[model samples]
Target: MDSKTPYKANLIKQQKVCERNFHKLMKLLPDLENNDNLVLSFYLAGWEGQARFQVLERAPYTTVLHVNLDAAWGQWLKLPEFRIRIYRDVRMAEIISVNKDRHFKAIYPYPNEKMLMPDEKEQLNQLFSEWLNFCLTHGLNN
Candidate 1:
């Protein structure tokens, strides 16, 4: 085995990330529970962009949200899209999918099906965290 952080799940970090994500999501969409979708325009000097958050499913204590970043990201035409699952009771949110790829494992075999990294889930949640931080810090409904 490679000498690394042993393959243990980082529950503490994941939980923290989830909680922060939930908080930022609520900040971006204060009417999330009452409304089905939220649209925000981001304007900074010469650049202007938009972000859309739509609730795909809603339950008593759970909600699935689809976030679309509507902007030109260099050469990529599709940009980035995220589907997040929110747990209202726990005040947590996690990335269910990114750009439509849903499967994530805490650890994966070296020669697995998709060449996924060992810590795919952790990486995904971290990416979500960074994205949310960027949106909250630089853009939004404020």
Candidate 2:
């Protein structure tokens, strides 16, 4: 792995959780292949309130595919938030840059006081399904 990879450490920390979520989502989407066409990466960021999940294309910096999840919103929605907001923001911005630029700033919305509820697992799976479908449809992976 590249030493300068931005989210290497974060990805390592959340590998199991992210993989579990990804596998569940993949099972739901029969059309998506787990091989070359699709790639998945996950990371955790320490925003003021709590840690958030960041998902991005597992390609080099030249590829312009990425996403960022808002921990605050995830907490609010009781879902495992992972970069949906960032994806939407980038679509709105129409910036054609690769994933090299950190286009977002951290902010504290609320402290993470609640425990990891059981339902969050299902919610995370659902969210990942939506994201995977989006990626497959847009040809972002292949």
Candidate 3:
């Protein structure tokens, strides 16, 4: 087998994961379809090494949720990741990341939050659910 075979397979796996999660988000928040600012790209861009999903914030004046993949699949270290940022009237209020070292950090505007690590499906679901509610409460989805 060629060395690139594994790498290619890893990439494909990562893409599938991202795609599944993207669909999950869509299922969770049907309102996402109404937001023109929302961009769902399950696959990596031509120049991007990571696949990501982004959501724009309403109250924060221009925030965005940037969900990124830390590394290719099959890598010894690396996992799904994300972050929140601000842009021109397009910011994401919450910040989150799953690092290559398996450290997961999520900062939210709300209290009583927990730190989530990669491969933790329950935690990940909670995180997304909270974010969806956060956006709804902040009037982003309206």
- Compared with the true structure, what per-residue lDDT tens digits does model 2 show for residues 13-123? 233444544444444333432232333332324322232222334332222223443344465565333432212212111122212322321221222344332233333
State in Å the error of residue 30, model 3: 0.5
- Order of models, best lDDT first: 1, 3, 2
Across residues 1-142, which tens digit of lDDT does each residue of candidate 3 receive?
Answer: 4434321223344334444444445553455435534433222223213334556454435434555543344277554465543332321222234343233332222222453323343355345545444333332221
Judge candidate 2 at residue 62 and give its lDDT: 20
Worst 10 residues of 2 by lDDT: 89-98
lDDT-superior candidate, 1 or 3: 1
Off by over 4 Å in 3: 1-9, 35-54, 57-63, 66-142
Off by over 4 Å in 1: 1-6, 74-78
Give model 1's TM-score versus the native structure. 0.87
RMSD to the true structure for each prediction, in A, is: 2.3, 15.5, 16.4
